[model samples]
Target: MVALRIRPAIVLFGDSITEQAFGVEGKVGWASLLASDYARRADVLNRGFSGYNTQMALPLLPKVFPPSKDNQEGSGILFCTVFFGANDACLPGERQHVPIEEYAKNLETIIGTIRACFNIFSSAATKDDDKFPIILMTPPPFDPAAWRKCRDLEEDGRANNVAKSYGEKVLELGKSLGCSVLNVWNLLEGATSPEVYGRYLSDGLHLNEEGNRKVHEGLMELIGKDHPSLAPLEAGATGEGLAVEEKLWRELC
Candidate 1:
């Protein structure tokens, strides 16, 4: 009997929230936790960049998924989670409020490019078993009252609303592209309150430890329900069976 070998590679790409590894202590970033959770079964690559928007990330996709010049065959990328748009919303001047139409175009480009790369590089047998699961995560809602304390309330509120609207549009686009949509805005809204996690936010935006956990848990639930391969591993269970626990402790400490 031939053994069915499963090789999973997850690439997490996004903004500061995806890049942050902060907490009171004994805590790891959600992406890192995700990596640790599947440490035994998969190779997780952290490609998250702080303050990167969709436009910026589109160009860097090749870096995360470089094609083999020698045409060497191996297990292709199994999953990719792209979370951008937050920084695009925060950009200065005309670029600040990225039009929903342009945002959709950028997302479509990213997904199309990835599909093209996989088709061009991976083997037919491997590609048949390896599904390219692209998960698009929307940005969580910003606290208007919190933003009021730092920046102009009216302007920030307007920008926040635009971001929310763009997020919804992005979800629609993801559906059109046959990708999974993780509505982080709605997920965080249900799991936490602005008054509670709002204080944990560093700069009227982005999450702290508790907030991060909320996002992570929401993601886990979403993935578990939809992706069969990820059902067994939970956020809290990672770093337990291997040397990851020690490393997690050191980093979190």
Candidate 2:
């Protein structure tokens, strides 16, 4: 029997923001964009759980990515993006609210688990030499004005300031731990006006098509710079003696 070529996985783990990454209704899903970019290059696995916070994500880690000795060559997780904090940034007394301090700890634990997987699965002689390929993403900015139109509530469940606070914590953890970080909050912060901000979101909480496009662009930029080997191959490259070959294809002819 021919041994099949194993494709490494690029895991996208997070909350509803992530779970809805493959958004419908003609909405462009950032996760889906990544999947397209990495087609035949790697598998993008979406492990986003709707309405989950760091606390909830902790318990689900082991089950989602069980340690395996067979994670060699093209197999196993090539990299993972840890993107939580949206739900956790909810106001105090809110259903999904998680304290900022506890949120930090949970993030650390998650990063550690991904590192451990590298050591367990990699053929590397020492863990110290291998830098784990992981990206920690900050939650996107919350637009309270847009949110109010959708929900009939006396009080807002989430606040932009609170979300910024969570984003800051993620940035801090990423710097201290030396992992790649994506500040989605800052990335999408350009929509300063209330009217403009609505364009990026579906219901103030979820991302719309244009918002997802911006995110995909940022992620691709990071990957191209930080994890160049894992970045998607571009089409039309000429080689020795002007021999051209097309490496880009969605499916076989």
Candidate 3:
């Protein structure tokens, strides 16, 4: 029989970037790294929808992340991260183009729905208990010039400046709503040059290994800083087997 191991979980809602958390190469993605690091500490769920914009994601939220009936099954949800906007920022007239204003409203509604389902509206819940912390991660900046080489997108399918504005909106919503914001837009901008930054993405629009690591590091830093209570155990050079051995000896004696 499979052993039952129930632990708090992490719900990651996003687009393709999140879907690739566990890369095809077995263990190269950010989700893979985070899952390994969080082993026995927290369970991570990937709820990514490829080619989906916020408008698409918002409607599906009710079906996928239904109201949390805590203790209905496993350990229950501890945290949730919303990573989207890459596709949503697609230039107008493109298949996935969502107007900038609508995009902002969509994100706000998503957060509100999540809060309602998590029971944040309960009068008895403490600020910490009912208040499920939401992490709003902006989409990573893309290199449209590089993307053009790969294939033809719309007249402005994806551009750095255009993408930055979407991420800026996410940052704005996060601040006003008291949500944790992971600004991949500005974060990846530190790469200095377009070529250097391009290295972070495999297809000019998606994340590569280096990019995954950058994301993982940013997530780790955020978790450690904002939610120390949910941080994973730090690995040391040696295992703690000696302590187990000592416990056995003492019990026998």
Output the number of the TM-score-best candidate: 2
| Residue-level lDDT tens digits of model 2 in 137-219 | 99887778678877866677998878888999999998898788998988887337546665778878788898888889999
State the lDDT at 6 in candidate 3. Answer: 57
**Candidate 2 global CA lDDT score:** 0.79
Scored by lDDT, the top model is: 2
Candidate 1, residues 1-253, lDDT tens digits: the string is 9645545456677777777743335666676666656665566666778867778777887776666533224545556778887766653564444556777788888887766666565432122245356788887667766777776555563355655776788789887777778887676562356675465565557776666777778777776655555444433455322222123444676
> C-alpha displacement of 50 in model 3, angstroms?
0.5
Instruction: For model 3, state the Cα shift of residue 64 in Å.
Output: 1.8
User: In the order shown, what is each candidate's alpha-carbon RMSD?
Assistant: 7.7, 4.6, 5.0
- State every prediction's TM-score relative to the real structure: 0.73, 0.86, 0.84
- Which regions of candidate 3 fall more than 4 Å away from where they truly are? 1-6, 68-74, 120-130, 152-156, 235-253
Clashing pairs in 1: none
Residue 158 C-alpha lDDT in model 1: 37
Model 1 lDDT, full chain set: 0.64
lDDT of 3 by residue, 105-211 (tens): 99999988877776433332224544667889998878876687777654447777778899989999998887889888777773366787888887788888888
